[model samples]
Target: MTAERGVHKPNLLVLVGPTAVGKTRLSIEIAKSCSCEIISGDSMQVYRGMDIGTAKITPEEMQGIPHHLIDVLDPEESFSVAYFQKVCRSLIPEIASRGRIPFIVGGTGLYVESVCYEFQFTEAGADEAFRQEQLRFSEQFGPEALHAKLTEIDPETAAKLHPNDQRRIIRALEVYHLTGTTLSRQLESQTKASPYNLCIIGLTMDRQLLYNRIEARIDEMVQQGLVQEVKSLLERGCSRSLVSMQGLGYKEIAEHLLDGLPLEDAIMKLKRDTRRFAKRQLSWFRHMKDIHWIDVTRGENFPDHLADIRAIIAGKFGIPLEYNYKH
Candidate 1:
């Protein structure tokens, strides 16, 4: 809705876009202009050893802007939307207290949505045995087979999830097995009222151009030693089944490093998976309400786009932004 509803509510500024759509550079610029601290909304960036593949921001890239919820967990530890919500909700007000806007920036649609709307996850009991069983089923029959199981139980949620998203697909299945109700049903029942006054910005570009960027980024990662990154994690005894390993870049490369998937094939799969992931991300964000969408298809015009975004933020939040406009 609005960036600031009243003095009673704190403001939250969120920037969401599919992978390789250029959120990182623009986010830093926006943060600098708005005096904001960024909280990474991505699930994978939380893991410490997953730098190159996750596109984790370097200290130099942050450019003195504070970033939270990144590199905070070991690759072996699990991160859930609940944890994201808890940490982000805590940080939002803390950042606001310091007179800085709490800016959430990344492409993890569900995780960002959960914090924005305060999604109350159902306390559906977990069945470890059932979870383990499903995991085994996925490994044996492939992730598509496991995704098919969820489709039979809850087609709505299954449609949003990628077949390669085994972590979420299995959780949806587990929720159904435990509660006898669809995860989609539970989500539909949750309140959409947000506690913070929100300004949500979504970035998009031409689909073909985005795919080209995704492929090029993957190629860059290979040159940056993506296989070695995965190899290091595996050498540290991180399981391939770990949620961190299931992320787009890590999963495909790990297959190459461990199970002898050819490097070429692995890179190809990673590129394809990332493209699909970006599509799914767009689909997810489309359902969210009140996002101001900006098209950044022309990479050379980023300065103009950045000025436009700053205007949007200034108008929404009623804040003064410091920037020099060139004619």
Candidate 2:
């Protein structure tokens, strides 16, 4: 909640916001100047074969800066906020030892928050029966219906999750029943305080423009063979109900392939759903105080946008934005 990244400590810069607001491009530019390495904060981008649908930047797109945590996990493997915070804790110090700034970039708010706010990951282990029951509920009633159940039991967790995130929905319900406590309370009770001082820079833009960009990007993803990528994952034994398949584009497309809906309809729904997801992202971000919001839409041009960000980073960290990108 506090944006006051203390002086005299290694800095961790987290760039987060609604999707389709140019986070990847902006993060790359900032990383180039900051002498930093990009650490992907996305959930779906962790899977190796989920390139286009996740809008993962290629090596060519990275322009030679190293990126970590993008393709480290198999599609069927489970990935949680606890796993992300664990990996980031190890990775940040290594990056700092190399004298490059550690920059985290993605629209996944919980992933960003888990690091920035130093939220703890409490492991109550698993409840097989509860997990199965919740999974069955998700399968029968859908992610949204389970989400409504979560709202009934734990509104805080429900508010944070998108209705399409079936995995999290199942997990939340499973946690509530397994521990006989709300996930929210357990999170607060078990949080291991972090040592890192953090700065979070959230990027946002106009709603209409953001939605337009989301739709356009969805079109581009489909054209770039998102369907083919999903098919490949399925052929590799990743099931439709796997944790990976619950990601935004993956679920909708998989549903289209299974049910009789046209691919076009699925594509349209995916775009619409993504736009809504972005809106929810913005809503979630606004609730967190002390966030330095950059309205890219309000800027007259890219340089102006860059200048505002550069100034904020300088003010926060007591270091000039100029650094060796040529390395």
Candidate 3:
């Protein structure tokens, strides 16, 4: 759409991929070239002091490009898709107002899609008593039992969510209890039209190569003091039960530290879980429409890959190969 200054600005330029797929560096380069600000769509990166496990980009690595939504929450605080959608919808226009593109960059599929489709959440707020009831039921009967309850009521939504994803399971149940409607059905009724002109780019590599990258990245995180990072968070009063600590790396490490599991086993579990997470991410993106996939494995040279991506950006979104960075 046209901005007040008569410049055309796409509502958003989204770059999404599985974890450890080189989204960070490429996003930085794209942001630099397009004069855009980066807004992280990652759920884990929103928590402060969750650097190593989340693979958060350091200030130096950001190369002076503005980024939003990272380090914005405490580990104990709760965040939701509704909140993410609200903040991003507001930020996109503001970024465009300053004559800069807004780039939604991360692997959090739900967060990205909520903004892209402009989901209208129902008015039913959290039912604290019901939530605590579900929490206690899960503690007493186990997560599967709790998930089974959801399956009986809303099998379609439960089919998409993992049994161990307690927060979402509880949320889905809460929505059902409060509104007498399944979350999936409610979402299906909302309008899917995005207010902005959206350009979505997805990155992928060979399956074997992607798995290797996930393994290597986990090893790198260990070298980067991931255990110590989790320990520091715990020492600072973050609990294992906090949703932030349930992230791939942090949760596995927490199991090691708290449940007396061996460190090596925890590391192995972390690697396996990350691989599964990447696969799930890919599955989510595949179901989305209008993604222009860029196969990074097709080229060995980083510069060549960057050039191809730039060409796609220019051709699809009308962004130039070079633009001044907004200070």
Candidate 2: minimum summed lDDT over ten consecutive residues — where? Answer: 1-10
Measured with C-alpha atoms, the lDDT of residue 63 in candidate 1 is: 91
Q: Provide backbone clash counts, one per model.
A: 0, 0, 0
Question: Higher-TM-score candidate among 1 and 2?
Answer: 1
Indicate whether candidate 2 or candidate 3 has the larger TM-score: 2
Listed in order, each prediction's TM-score against the native is 0.96, 0.91, 0.90
Per-residue lDDT of 150-248 in model 1, one digit per residue for the tens? 998899999999898888998899888988889899889978998887889999999999999999999999999898998998999998878898888
Which regions of candidate 2 are displaced past 4 Å? 1-8, 187-194, 298-300, 323-327
What are the RMSDs of all candidates, in order?
1.7, 3.1, 3.3
Q: How close is candidate 2 to the true structure, as a TM-score?
A: 0.91
lDDT of 2 by residue, 24-129 (tens): 8778888888788988998889998898888889988898999999899988788888889899989998999898889999888777778876786556677767
**Global local distance difference test of model 2:** 0.81
- How should the candidates be ordered by TM-score, best one leading? 1, 2, 3
lDDT by residue for model 3 (104-147), tens: 99999988988888888887887778988998999899989999
Q: State the displacement of the C-alpha of residue 309, model 1, in Å, after optimal TM-score superposition.
A: 1.1
What do the candidate models score in CA lDDT, each in turn?
0.90, 0.81, 0.85
Give me the candidate number with maximum lDDT: 1
